[model samples]
Target chain A: MPVPDDRKQQPKTTADAKIPGAYEGETVTRRRFMTASAHTAGGIATAAFTLPALGMAFGPVFEKEQVRWEAVGPTEDFPDDTYIPRTITLSPGIGEVGKSTVYVRRYNDTIDSEVKDEYNDYVAITSRCMHLGCPVRYVEASERFICPCHGGVYDREGKVSGGPPVRPLDRFYTRVRDGIVEVGPRYSLNSELRRFSPRDPGQAIDGVGQYLYPSRPSIRKLPGT
Target chain B: MAKLPTTSGTRPRGTRAETTEAPATAPQRNKLQETGVSTIDWLDERTSLSAGARWMMFRKIPKGTNWFYTLGSATMFAFLSQAVTGVFLAMYYDPSATRAYESVRFLTNEVFLGEFVRGMHKWGSTVMVILIFLHMARTFFFGAYKYPRELNWVIGVVLLILTLAMSFTGYLLPFDQRSYWATTVGVAINGTGPLVGPYLSDFLRAGPEFGATTLARFYAIHMLLLPGIIAAMIGAHLYLVARLGTTAPPWIRAESSPELREDSK
Candidate 1:
C-alpha cells in the first residue's frame, strides 16, 4: 500500500492511529451505543433531581411586616419562682407581619439567692444574648448568665462579668397589679443600674453605690426624694 | 463483467484498484446501499441512541449530573433556589424581634406548603454545605489545587467560610428564644476580643441586646448583605474553574487505544 507522503513528516504518536479490528472502524454495535446513552441519561436525571426546592417557597420570603403574636396564656401562670421559659409570638407591625415564638423567662430574684415573695421584684429577661444575639441561659449553679455564642458571662443580677458582652442582660419593664403580671418592651436603664451588682436594694431607683444583700426586704431608699 | 465506478474521479488511484478487485461487485454495492437506507427508516421507529444523545447534552443534564462533581452546579442551583424561597418567606417573616418568631409560625403552619419550601431552603443550605466541602476535598485529594490552580482553591476556601457564616447568621433570623439568646452568646464571645470587644458586640447586634433593632440588623445582614457578596464570589469562583479545565490526576497519562498501540511506529 502506498502511504500518503504527509504521514512521513507528521510526528509519530500512537494516539493518532485509528482503533483496530476490521469492523471496529465501521459500525458501532447497537448495544454499546445504547449503554453509553444510558449513562448520559442517568447523569442528567441526577442533576434534575437536585435543582433545589426554589420556586415553591419564594412568595413568603419577600413580604414585609408579616408576623403576628398569639398569646398562649396569662401572666399569673408565670409563678413567683424562676418560671420555665414560655414560647411567645411577637408581631412585626407591618402588613400581616409577625415575629417568631421567642421564649421569655421570668424570675423573682437572682438565681444564687432565695426566691422572694415581694410583688415588684419580678424581672423577665429575654433568653437571647446581648451580643450576636445568641440565646443566653441562666446557669443556676454558677449564678451566672451564660451566652452560648461566644461565652459572654453575666452575674446573677444580669450584669456582664466576663466574655465579650459590652452591656448587661436586657431587662423587661414589668407590672403586676391585682395579681396580674404584664411585660412591656425592653428599655435601657441608667449606667449604674446596668452593672454587676449583688444587691438590687429592693426598690432603690437611684442609690449611686449601696450594696443591698439578697432578700433584704427593707433596704434604705436611695438618698434624696 | 467489470462494473462501472460511480463517482470514480475523486477516489484515490490505489484505493480504487483495490476496491475493483474486492467483493464490492455491482450487485453487492446495490445491496449495501439499499440496507443503509432501510436501516435509517427502521431506526426512526424506535428510541434510537441519536435522540438520547441530544437529550443527554441538554435536557437530561439537569437530571443526571447528581454526582459529587456536580456539587458545584448544585450549589449554584441552591443559591437561586434559596433566593426564590426566601422571597416567599420574606413575605411572612418579620424583621423585628417582637414579631419575628410569630411570623415564622404563620409561614410554617398557616401558609400552603410554606413550611415545606421553607424547610427545604433550610435543609438545602445544610446540603449545600456538605456538597461544597466534598467538592473541595475532591479538588484537594486530586491535587487540583496546585500552582496555576491555587487561586481556585483559595476561592473555594472563601466560599466554604461564607457557607458557614451564612448558616451562622441565619440561625438568628427566626427571632426565637434559641435565636435571640444563642446570638447573644455569640455576640458576647465576640466581645472577648480585647479592647474593642464591647464595640464589636455592639456593632454585631447594633446594641447591647437582641431586640427590635438587633433583629432588623441581623435580618438585613442575613438576607440582603451576605447573599450579594456570596453570589459575587460564586461568579468569580465559577469563572476561575471554567478557565482552568478539570485537572487530571497528576500521575495518569492518556494512552493510545489498543488498535493504535499496534500501529505505533
Candidate 2:
C-alpha cells in the first residue's frame, strides 16, 4: 500500500522539517536537545548510585574469598576405616550458623581411588550434600553420608552411591600441619572424583555440567588443582 | 461541639452569644466545625486531594460486584497489618546473625506485647499469602484478567512473586535452626538453575556459603527492597483497577439497551 503524499511522515531533523521555526542550519530543535540532555543527565545520575549499590551487593560473586586452614584434631583421632565429625567455621564472625561439620579421616589406601596428592593426605568430606546443600550426617553403620532434607546418599568414598545427588559429595583440601590434621578451602568433585572449582550444592560439575554450571569467582578450587 | 484549635481572627469567638436557634442566613461560624472545614478547604485548595479521594472512593463498580470484590482490599489490609507489626518488631528484632535467634527469643519471651506482634507478623504472612491467592483466584475465575486489564494482571503477578520473595527472605530473620537450614536449602534450590544458578546462589549467600552478611541481606530485601516494590506495584494495581472499572461476574450477562435491541430487531 503506497502512502499518499499528504499522509507521509514528516522529516526527522529540524533542518529538513517544514515547520515555521525549523531553520536550514538547525539539525535538532532546542526542546529535543534539552529533553535528551536532561534525560541523559538523569540516567547518568541514577546509574552513579545504582551501579555501585548493585556492585556492592553483587561484589561477593566476583570477590575472592580467603582460604583459611584450621586444624581439627591430631592424625590419630581420625581413623581411615571410619569418619570423625569436626566443626569448622567456613565463614567467620556470624557465630554458630557459619560453622559447618566436615567429616574427616586419614586416607585409606584400599578405598581411595583419586590419584595420591599432597592435599588429600587425609580425606575430608563437607557435610553439605551434593543435592541441595543440606547438612548430611555420616551414618556409622552404613558408612554413608545421608542428607535429611532430601534423600541423597553418598557412599564411603563420598561418591554418589544412591538417590538424588548430581555429583559426588564436595571435599576440602586436607593437610597435616604440626602433626594435626587441618581442613582448608572446599572443592567439588565430578562423579569420577576429578577435582574442579567449588560449586554450590545441586550443580553438577560433570561433563556438560561443568560448562552449564560454571565455578563462581569468589571461591575457586585450589590453584591448578 | 468538639474543641478546635483556634486560628487568630477567622473564627467567631462568641459561642455563648450564638443561641441554639440562630438564624440559618446569619450563620455565626461554629469555630469548632469551621476550623475543621477551613483546614480541609485550605488543604483541598492547594492539593485538590479531595477530588482524587472522591475519584478513587466513588468509582462506578460494575453490576454483580459482591463480597468477592473485597479480596483485593483484604490483601491490602493484610499487608498494612504486616507492615505495622513488622515496624514495631524491628524496634527490638536484631538482624545480627549471632544475636538474631537470641533477639527473637527475647522479643517473644520478654518485651511487652512482643509475642502478640511477632505472632501477628508470622501468622499474618500466611494470611497475606492466602488472601493474595484468593484475590488472584477471584481475578482468574471472573475473567477480570482479560483485555485492557492484562497489564494489571502482570503487575499483580509481580506483586505475588514479590510477596513470596518477602516470605522467603522473612523466613530467615529469626535465624533459628529451621531458618538457617531452610535458607540453605532454598538457596541451593536456586542454584539448581542452569547457567546463572551458580552465580545467583553466591549472590544470595553473599559468597560460596552463608556468610556474615546473609541475614542482614535477607532482612534488607524483605523489609526494604521487596516492600517498596510491592507497595509501588499495589499503587499501580489500584490505579488500573479504578481506571478500568471492573468486570461484572461471569453469571451477569450484559443487558442490551432498548436502542440496540430495536436496531437488532
| TM-score of candidate 2 against the unseen true structure | 0.90
True contacts kept of 1: 0.13
- Candidate 2 interface RMS: 0.7
Q: Which portions of model 2 show Cα errors greater than 4 Å?
A: A1-24, B1-31, B262-265
Model 1 has an lDDT value of 0.57
TM-score of structure candidate 1: 0.45
Model 1 chain B weakest 10-residue run by lDDT: B57-66
Per-residue lDDT of model 1, residues A122-153, tens digit only: 56555555544555787758867887657888
Error of 1 at A25 (Å): 79
Q: Which residue runs of candidate 1 sit more than 4 Å off their true CA positions?
A: A1-225, B1-67, B254-265
Candidate 1 lDDT tens digits, B195-231: 4454455456543333346667677777887889888
> How would you encode candidate 2's per-residue C-alpha lDDT over A16-93 as one tens digit per residue?
786577777777888888999999999999999999999999998899999899999998898889999999998899
